[model samples]
Target: MASMPGPTDAFARPLTDLRVSVTDRCNFRCRYCMPREIFGPDHAFLERDELLSFEEITRLVGLFTTLGVHKVRLTGGEPLLRSDLPTLIAGIAGLDRITDLALTTNGTLLPRHAADLAAAGLDRVTVSLDALDDEIHRAISDTRVPVTAVLAGIEAARAAGLPVKVNTVVKRGVNDDEITAMAAWGRREGITVRFIEYMDVGATNGWRLDDVVPAAEVVERLSTLGPLEPIGDGTPGGDVGDVQTGPGQVAERLRWSDGAGEVGVIASVTRPFCRTCSRARLSSVGELFTCLFATSGTDLRGPLRDGATDDEVVTIARDTWTHRTDRYSEERTAETARDDRVEMSYIGG
Candidate 1:
């Protein structure tokens, strides 16, 4: 038996979570994410061979596991759009070191893949659903994708025994009106609805400081339906803040000082939590991103393809994480207001 390697951060900002983008392709043309105009029919995505193979990804995951990554999330432009993604899920699940394994998807393809993903050892799922109405959803996403597809997908995930979480990005003058309705939908479906403040992760979204519907407004709107009690704060892994919503008012995962179903806000725009951001993202092309708003990443593809040793990769990974001082959202209104940032599609959300 071999002993595990010691950690690098003394559990300070430890590498506990890894988000791997399986593909840079998606089905919808979300205006904020991957607008069709920028990623039109002529867009050149990475070829199948250019992507990190499941075998290669698993090797890296094994290394990440040894370096203290206990949770893994599969993300992408849309993860299910990738071929045989459940196979990749199973491969990661086989690694016993991972305590929590999850996937984030657009939910357009989830109805077809939920059970298979759960069977592949996926522990949970987070679905990106901006609206409940078909027309509004299509308009917001800049695609004709029906909201019923997402609803059906959520149902399928529930039936598959996967704990479902719904993420709604609240963009002012867009889908912000749906906050209450979205929270209602989540409560009815037994899903945790997390409202995320509109962020300027990339330069393509036409992000303006005024376009951001603050997290406080999200709570206020949802409070219209029912009284929202402040559930105590959760861990720093996701920067989730407390708010509970329900009819009977019974909260589950969130330890509510007053009982109700849990609701949270990812205050990326107003209350940036970059200091506690412990997650790292790996692009489908094998680039490693230290922060979500990063303009560029260290190209691990070259080194990995060239047969870099695990020790070398891990050292690079640690150095990158330790040296990271990104606070993009916090500085956006000031320093980055005039700067151009990378598109979210290239890095996955």
Candidate 2:
């Protein structure tokens, strides 16, 4: 048998997490990620051969584990939409070096698949839930998809014994009004809810700086409903911070937790955590993205399909990661001007 690979020759940034997009297809068309009208019938998605198969994904993941990545999150435009996803999950979970294996989905298909997914050894699940009210949810998602389905999906995942995190992208004048309601639902369900800033991820979203509902404002809005005392960060591996920067930032940190389940804000836009950003995204088509806002990615698929050894793939992945210096959020002004960035649906959130 081949000896295990050594420390990555060029890996840097203290990398520890990898997000793999299993498919580029989504059932819902969230305005920010993929507006429905634009993504209608004519838009071309990846063909069957373009996507990395389960075996190919496992090989890439094995190399990532060798390069000091310990956690992996399966994502997609909507991961659950992919058929037999649990089989893929089981394969990745079998990798002993991968301590954490989670998935992010739109929750439209989770109710039917949650149990199987948990049984397949997925460690955790996060579902995107934009609103509690069906009308508002339909508006936010830009589809007739009901909010009830997503809520039921969350309940199913919880019943399946999988820890669930509800993710909401709060856009000012849009879903921001639903923050408190969503938090109340989470508290009742005993699920951790994370509010994400409306990010300028892809050019298709028509991201406007005015649309961003700052993390500070989200906590304040929730605090008005009840006294939410700060608790420890729900997951240590979570990108959100547990520490307060100063008195000014303290309110933003503690105001939304009632000591039951915590509220997290991924301040990717307002508070850039680029220096500690240790994420690498593997697109469904086998390109590796160093940054979520990146316009281009190195094609690992070509090399892998060409019979490149694990060492060669590892070297390619390592070189791409080490020379990494992407802080799009910090340099938001400059990044906003670039036109060819990959859409969030293609890269997974």
Candidate 3:
């Protein structure tokens, strides 16, 4: 028999995806996330002892699978910054219940760790690169790391036989002009690209409603290549990363009508996906967050480290998830956007 839904929140949304933040330390202080003004030189990051050990993480992941999570993605302020990260990848890959395992990174480190990461059982990677132009890339990431570095990382991942996708956050008057350019690059490179609407993830990004380039317009601009078609069930070429569709899916995958290539868009701003949202974020220090815009999180680390039994810990997660009433995106307003929510860097994007 096929497996039934695991655990459902207040709205009956099943928990299927777990984004695990391996660490909170990042190399690049992207303006949208860990901006230099805030995460400047004087800022302090998590200590090694404070973060969940690989054993603790793997154990928690195992319990998550029992609660209906089959997809796991390793994330970070920059996951590659974590030392001996392949060890953690290897551990998560060993979990029998995990159907898919992926990671999101800045991609600068992939050139050095791609082969090792793939060899350790990483399934795929999604690199965060905003623009092809050096100036725009520099402005967005607030770093001198050239676009060439990210491109090199993509090549390295490909050579290691790991599927690669590029994620671009489109902020109006920012990188919005690069939508078609990005699609063209992906087509030329035979890679899948996903465009994300600039979201009010954290309070400090200075989010404005007008700054959001709607996903429809992004898709419209890309349609210039050729009319795009939604890549849904039974759609050919939809097998890219085996990306799913329907309820609880974030990215809406689409392919060129002429079949030249494929692309996707995440319209969280103009279109709220809260009704079927199924992702649970485990913070770098072990807080279990039920929503991306959550103001507070349930501290699983405290109880786990306090010697709670596996059953007890599992109960904590289940109860917290079951009682969750998060719909921040659906109810986003000028007011809600100002809520002091958790930073994307702390929980990974």
Candidate 4:
């Protein structure tokens, strides 16, 4: 098969990864992404009719694959909450062009669905596990669920033969004390725990520079636990000691020099990788957002529902990407920070 034309943006970045949000509801109200104070019981989530159907999502995935999107991750406020997720997973996995199929979840529900998710062609899973300390975990996630539940989910995912990666959002005073604990746990379990710098993704969460824990600080803290080395550093034809594990890879992966284990860090705020970001996000309602901090998205749902053909939808998406010039994180400022960016809950982080 000849190569399909890539949707190269204004900065010459091709769309290689797509994060599709299947639903805008979650079980846990993580303070960083979604806070209970705001997303309370009365909060209005997208109605079932407003969300894209599984078939519509599958069609969009097919279109994305043709635009050089080889990696597709199913995300959500909590993807498992979307009913019959395996069916959607099977549809995307069947698209031969989608070489990588993954999902990001809070992990509380993985124990029941991991096997089913894996059976339906999921290649791997990323679980948002902020801390192993039960109290700290509850504090960050703002949920009554115990930490052991998430651990069980991780075990279930591994039992299902799916590679698991844990994501920890490091905020200075919130979970910073547990950095070493989390790293040690990851080393002990042979799971790659990625520490993400506290980012100002949405309008809420009381984001502040003081709360932000720089990636360099995280590396320093982990170094106290063990001698860490970049995954490919000091080796021939290997990536140097940087957050970049590979081309367009966001995390800078490193390993324990003593042969214990490995971890990664995403320094979006301090060490921005906007220049090489190849991700395009689709909201539950079919809006395409070029940047995670985007205030608005091109409404593909309206166009598609209004009787637009597949060719027309493709043209619209391609045109949006080709004309994209967003680099929000790299240019983040107090003024821009208050730009009413879309909430991370609405669009999967």
Query: Lowest lDDT 10-mer window, candidate 2?
Result: 242-251
TM-score of each: 0.90, 0.90, 0.95, 0.95
**Candidate 4 C-alpha lDDT tens digits along 1-349:** 2346988999999998899999999999999898999999999889999999999999999988888888899999999999999999999999979878989999999999999999999999999999999999999999999999999999999999999999999998888999999999999999999999999998987787788899999999999997988766422113733222345668887889999878888888888888988899999999999999999999999988898888788889999999999898899876766668899988899
Query: Against the correct fold, how does model 3 do in TM-score?
Result: 0.95
Q: In model 4, what is the error at residue 140, expressed in angstroms?
A: 1.0
lDDT of 1 by residue, 67-121 (tens): 7777788988888888998889999999978877888888878778888999999
Q: Runs in model 4 with CA error above 4 Å?
A: 1-3, 233-245
Error of 4 at 221 (Å): 0.8
Better of 1 and 3 by TM-score: 3
Better of 1 and 4 by lDDT: 4
How many clashing pairs per prediction, in order?
3, 0, 0, 1
**Model 3 over residues 76-107: C-alpha lDDT tens digits?**
99999999999999999999888788999999
Distance from true location, Cα of 142 in model 4, Å = 0.9
User: Which one wins on lDDT?
Assistant: 4
Ranking of predictions according to lDDT = 4, 3, 2, 1
> Candidate 2, clashing residue pairs?
none
Q: For each candidate, what is the lDDT?
A: 0.76, 0.79, 0.88, 0.89
lDDT of 2 by residue, 52-132 (tens): 999999989988888777779999888887789989999999986887899998887878998999999998888888889
TM-score of 1: 0.90
